[model samples]
Target: MSAIEALYIFDEHNATILEHVYRGRPPTASVLLPLYLSHPSPQPSLIYLPNTHPPTLVYSIIQDRLLFLSPSSAESEPLLALEFLHRVADALEDFLGSPLLASKIESSYDVVAQLLSEMCDGGLVSNTEPNALRDVVEAPNWVKGLLGGVGLPSSSPSLNPSSQTPFSLPRPSLPRAPSAATANPVPWRRANVRHTSNELYVDIVETLSITLAPSGRPLSALAFGTVAFTAKVSGVPDLILQLNAPGGILNTISLPVFHPCVRLGRWKEKPGELSFVPPDGRFVLAGYEADLLGDDHLASFTSTSSTSKSLASLNLPATPAVSVSLGPTGADFEVRLSISPRFQNKPSASTASSSSRGGLGSRSASAFSATGTTAHPHIEEVKVHIPLPAAVRTIADLRTSRGDAQYAPGDTGIEWRVAAKDVAALLASHHGGSVSASATLRGSVVGEEEEDEETAPSVSLEAGSRWEYDEDEGGGYQTSSSVEPAQQRNGNGKGEAEAEQRSKRRVALNRVLMPSSATVSFSVKGWLASGIKVDALMVDAKRSKGLGAGVTPYKGVKYLTVSRKGVEARC
Candidate 1:
């Protein structure tokens, strides 16, 4: 029995674009659209509609503003149907270019139909790889069109005109030979791939999400890492990569996921080793999550003793803190960013000398080492975002020690940006080198002004004496009493007590304007907070084919940590 019964595509306007039935009986698009839309949005990828004849399971995904729906009525692996839908979307985009548009699909219905039919045969997946499909399904060629329009054969004739007799019958058309990609056993990679320059690159990027309490203790910390590999070489090449961490590779990473090409058995035997035949171009090789606060670190944090010292041990490239000061006038806040000493130190002699020689000649030597053993890491793209309360009317008197701060009138937050050069300069200007540096950004908050309302004057008759009191424009009391003794009732104690109450009221007013949290966004190169590094990337010649003998591919790896307003400091 077929797993996928039918496929339906809808445009942004909720109108059907294309509908294809593979096998079995399924509900019509008219009936399915309403049932799918009936659910509240952010709808689940899988939905069950029991009202249908055999009951239907709808799997839907939205990409490039196009909706892809796959309905199945039979018992089958749910992942198979969902993965097929994703593959269909990817294949369409690969053929039609990025941002798959409705008009493109409508105009190229013939190509789409061929792709869908080839990718799924009788509701079972046949071929979904873009590289392999290119060999089977012919793409539209403008050159062939131009040749055919002018009454000429699309391809050049194999036989010469002199070799053919005048009365010779037209030669029978020959069957086209199968392409190498279609015949190759490997499904993901194309066959006979060749490149003028062979290079392999491994880029490890980790995004940080850290939450800190008002006392500066970390509540939670996590790093989501992805390993992206790029292989440009002739023929099929098998690659083996090794990764290492200070706290053992297995313990450092959790919930690891790998590409289909990677060998799971090898990874299972050796936790940090990956064996795979990579795709022709760039693709993600693996993904993993790491807890920055491990058991030991968490234990230290739980202890009341020296929480700051424990945080410093994390060796973060940059840390941000926000503090607000309340005064009689208004509220002022400051955002301070501290650059770690590891990033502040000067580059090694090798890097400094190579940089001084400045030219294309220094390119190779200046390249960062894959392990980051000799490279001097630097912080860049530093930005601090402070979200203010709605009561804050505007931010004024914005100032920064090393960068620029901006605030728009209607914006709900303030942004302070410090470029890499400024951060480097600040570190270099330190009186004594090898010390951490900091930058401060200060701004004043101006809240919405409140209007003062006037109240009726109070008249008090005490012991046969009539006293009338009114508040003057200066906010002081003016009293007119029929008896002179009543004037002496206002004494220094009452005046001082009233002054203290007014001071408390102003402090409360300023508290409303303070920002609740500040988030930091930055990108750090040649450094990873997780302390994971590439040990080696080796090409296995014995198991590989097509790669030339003694050809050493240029290999490089890069480490990057990015925080897109993910690090938050709460008030």
Candidate 2:
């Protein structure tokens, strides 16, 4: 089996702060650091050091200004070593608080040693889950450390009291609790877990990565989703979750992956049903990939009518529509971005049908105890980035109707950030109606001034037309003899340079200054663009193991949609 030979952690200064050898004689940090530095920055996660005695594979990850490197001499799975490094980082952060500072590790060496030992057994990965580790490994506390300095023991003992901690107060020896691994067959959960207030929470978050063509057609649209569950129930409880999507479960969802605790047989029978005995505390219950583009249209109804196309477009997830227009002088440009809330005041087919029969609660009164209210996803932190051409010297006169916008002199692009609350307020002001918030960025692009000479012919023609009108009216105006010649002479002066400049301007505007594409980043909470809803969560009393009778738990659910540079539209 593939095993970790050694693990090394280096600070930002390329100095080894911690090193642990598991099996083989791997190269030291000094030897690997030079080779790593010789390569270009932002190195790949897996690097092969062929120059070493036995071609070694170095799997590295950077977190909180620290470099974590795992060296394996034998052929190993790349993801296995990388995932192990991630687990170590998470374990340390869980013990020493977030943003695992170097000082925290320096002060709590004893706790670190115990964690490293329990996480890996003889170079093989072992107890890496944080919830399971918390039961076996006790985290050090500063309050107890202060008491120990004065030779006084604290009231309560540390979680992992077996290991000796530096500056820890003296304590009266107490009976140790049995190891959780021995007490329970499932090593992931602790035995006899008790909670005064039993509660279960499910949070479903979907991230959107969509692209819309300039013609308002979807080029590519996808939603990556994850289901995170938290169980604080007293005993091991078996639960089943049901999800509903309008397009049907199998057709809507693809590439589904579940946790080890889940029952694959249950899902195979009922696609949207998830039956599992959840681990204590929080964990990712399931994950899925959905194709938003293909599912947006109805397969049964194929219509060529314009109205059908319009209705279909409305159901798709909202994407920022970007438009660029050049000013009278092609040197100036204006960019407009529009954001429309996707799920505002749009009732689903089920909701509408139920409402017709005396509202939702009355229609579904017998089926569910409480008819839940549907909340639209709240989209926030709308930011759009537009790149400019290299030849453009300056960007000035930036104005946006909403949010703050900035563009420095040397900056190659302009960024516009608008708050989500602002978008909500605008929608609320419209009395629960769908509102579109727009931002306009207008700037002057400076290039070769002689490029304007190409347009002089059009300018002269206008002057001649004006002179003709004045002559026919017999008005006291400048004759065409004087006005037309001056305009024509001006147009003829830089014919060659003007032609070259026009070509350059076309290349600059089409290839450079004009925005070819714009990227948008935003987050939406309490909503799923796919219109997926959690039907219910039930505990199977007959099939469940290790549970007392008549024990009820409080349940809650939440939905979120996030787009981090995931939405792109070509201008």
Candidate 3:
């Protein structure tokens, strides 16, 4: 069966446990009933579980593993409850990062969304109809974007909530000049054209379908006469007719459009050309692909998997601009990037000219108006977003020796997290000793430049690394980033991994828990074998008691170097 089925089995197990715990009396009727049944008292012995609470601890935990949890234990029918839980868990496993059985007591709305989607698709249709899926829309934006006008019948898609990211991968551009046709042609297809409600999206396929002569000379690029694409937008951009062929690709060419607002007379069209007819909406142009199949008559087709560009999503800024925190506070593993560009301090002379032009009588005030300062502030502000989680938090001074060589330092990477008891048990099981520890409030030493950039943090083994940021409650915060052009220059598909970056940042940390007194540190002499360079560093700590973290910033202070020798602050 599916994963959900297995989870249902586990749920049943939980329900059975609850049933036994709740039903304290013996299975025999005498043990259950009251002493005087003729005049039944309020506290009758017949009800198995009239007073006790259902199981409270609903979740289990394992190291770097998934957790299994039941939402409720008040199931009158324990078997039924178990079945429901298992079915829900099985369907939502793709989004959960860990194994479900080991861990328990889970709570999150993202889980609810997944369960709902699965039930709609599964046999739960009778209980939850397809129309019920419309209830998922708590927000108008989500409803409008996802559902549009089409009503879902029943099978609902699981919203991988954390699957919020729609990642893009770069690929080699298709050749402009396509290769010659083969004996049998492969199918040529077009991607779905998505358009807003009022907007029209046309797939201008086959318009430029080209097949060169036997001698490899340009044969003919399919041309279409005037095609009236009744568009919704006024300043519609020049329609881009792009083609990926054997040799090269075509830059965008303009296309004709007529809107309702414009056009004082009859719409003109080129004679002897086919007109487009959309299924329900207005159509514009038509195009299609010519596929030549098999034998190297021209080329071969092969598909390759690809990795995404490093932080490619950075380009698309939110329109109308919502503020963000790249490395917002409270994030243990953080990179605070200040991307908002600085504005011009002085206004331009446009107002000065205006002051001179308006009869010169309004001259004094004209200079101010000519300056034309924007009353509304520009959509420029620091946005700090930390995509990476705290699991990557670096711990310091973890050194190791291979053979006769001296011990060298390296950053510690946790395969996973374990409960304090579990860690102690695992350590005890290995050797003739036992150890105990608690969750920690930790800090790392990072190196920064005068400005945060590609330069990695520097560490001095001699001086103790300490770039401390201690602020009072409700204090301000700091963030930094830099410009490294060397890597951007050779973006020609090379040196991506080894590109020289001035904004290198190295962090060495010794995370000692609040209740601990021992010292912990990790360091490495050089980062050649490993391309790890710490360019920026900051010690971000505050009273982790009340509202949020408070930050203290040193205006002149830049980088922090950390190593086994200890932490050092560099001005």
Candidate 4:
């Protein structure tokens, strides 16, 4: 039997806030708290306490600064106990609002007790869905108080002071039909749901992680994607969403995870097709990972030997190429950034343009506008980070051809920011031009000066060697023969050799100050690096209930790609 013996909640100060027992005699909060705390910080979720009377397995999770712990003496499934704790936390947040504070739980003990009892039956998992729980539980009186203060009618009945009935006398009750909690078929959806506005939104966001070699060859490129869905309708509606990707999603996406409401059978039969009854509010519908450099794409890179062509096949909006050059003086270095030509050209809503938009393929912008979709894709927050060696004391004479560059004396790196407006200006200057736009940043390296040991005074050791002080010259003591050689060396070729040695040392020191890699970060909307796009989102009226006839819901889809220091080029 999967049973949770007891649950204990602790506040940020490790003070016990609430405790409840579900089934069987188990260790109390006092006994379990110290044993659990004995472990080192960043403790694991599950721990075994052999010192207890019956020996218990404790499962714990921390959320919103509150610690939830469950201890079980009986042999049970570890995941069940862990998941139930999470469900309890979520249910409380749904009922009491977010940032589940200790005071909130202390004031709403009645509601919390009911929630715990209903969620677990004799220590076995029962009804944990918030939507279903709302039907069985009554709203706290504080909510009614707030409504009454606002001059709105309260749902609960109020008592009359002039009544003749006795205080203990029971009031007559009327017969009623089965409540929605028992009558509703779905466990996750509440009964009789209604909304004034009918709308559905699908937002797809992908983050890119790419590394390129100094020779402009892609080492690794990956895209992590998430789909967030928000549904606000007047009834329980069924939705079928179709997703399309270039070269088919079956071969492109890997390690995909979907929400519980989604129909897995449909997804397994036809990849990229999602069938589900959505939750009422915003929630993550799915997540996936796609590789930008597949075997076939890498093969193309080998044949053409062009990094831009390979990246273009991935539909990248802006490709950054960083090259570092050492100046002849060896005390200065230059960093150059070349943006892709595609960024300068305006993206069209044509099929050809969509196919080449950044990933494998995506729907055109015109299609979205025709369906009342807003938020066209654009690029913003373009920044480049160049890391310097620790030995460099400072970066002097810092200059940039575009935007701004900042560096601190002891900082290990330099940040270069190019605003979106500046990027637009640069692109406009190169209007209708095939050449890619470029920006350059130059800086001088100032390293800590090393003390020359050769310049120190030297003494010659011999059997009768003596040191003498020069009174007239006011110079320190020195060997009599050593002064003659020192004067001769300065007048001959030795001085030139020493100057050459010092120049070589400066060059080596400057080499240490040069950056080894540069990373680029930016966000692009209306495009995806994986070329995934929504084809359609249709409601199934036959299976839906309470939806009015001729009601057309507003549907919108947005695509966004982000890179947070994920694109790196090694020098």
Lowest summed-lDDT stretch of 10 residues in model 2? 355-364
- The estimated TM-scores of all candidates read 0.77, 0.77, 0.16, 0.73
Write the number of the candidate with greater lDDT, choosing between 2 and 4: 4
Ranking by lDDT: 1, 4, 2, 3
Better of 1 and 4 by TM-score: 1
Residue 462 lDDT in model 1?
A: 47
Please state the error at residue 17 of candidate 4 in Å. Answer: 6.8
Model 4 alpha-carbon miss at residue 475, Å = 6.4
Question: How many steric overlaps are in each model, in order?
Answer: 0, 3, 73, 3
Off by over 4 Å in 2: 142-182, 295-318, 341-373, 389-392, 428-437, 447-511, 543-548
Name the candidate that leads on lDDT: 1
Q: Supply candidate 2's per-residue lDDT for 388.
A: 73
Candidate 1 lDDT trough over 10 residues, lowest sum: 354-363
**Relative to the true structure, how large is the alpha-carbon lDDT of every model?**
0.77, 0.69, 0.24, 0.76
Residues 1-571 of candidate 1 have per-residue lDDT tens digits of 4477899999999999999999877898989999999999989999999988889889999999999998888777878888899999998987677889998889888778988988998888988887666545544455347645754333323212334577987775432435444466777886557677888888899999998887777888899999998888778999999999998999999999998899999999999999999987777899999998885765775567676665765667777888886445446777888777667534555444532111111224355432132256656668888998898878878889998888898798988888767877887776655446888988887766421211434433344444445456645544444545445465445667866875666557767888988898988776788989888888899988989999978787777888999788887
Instruction: Flag clash pairs in model 2.
Output: 138-159, 138-160, 148-169
Better of 2 and 3 by TM-score: 2
- Model 3 backbone overlap count: 73
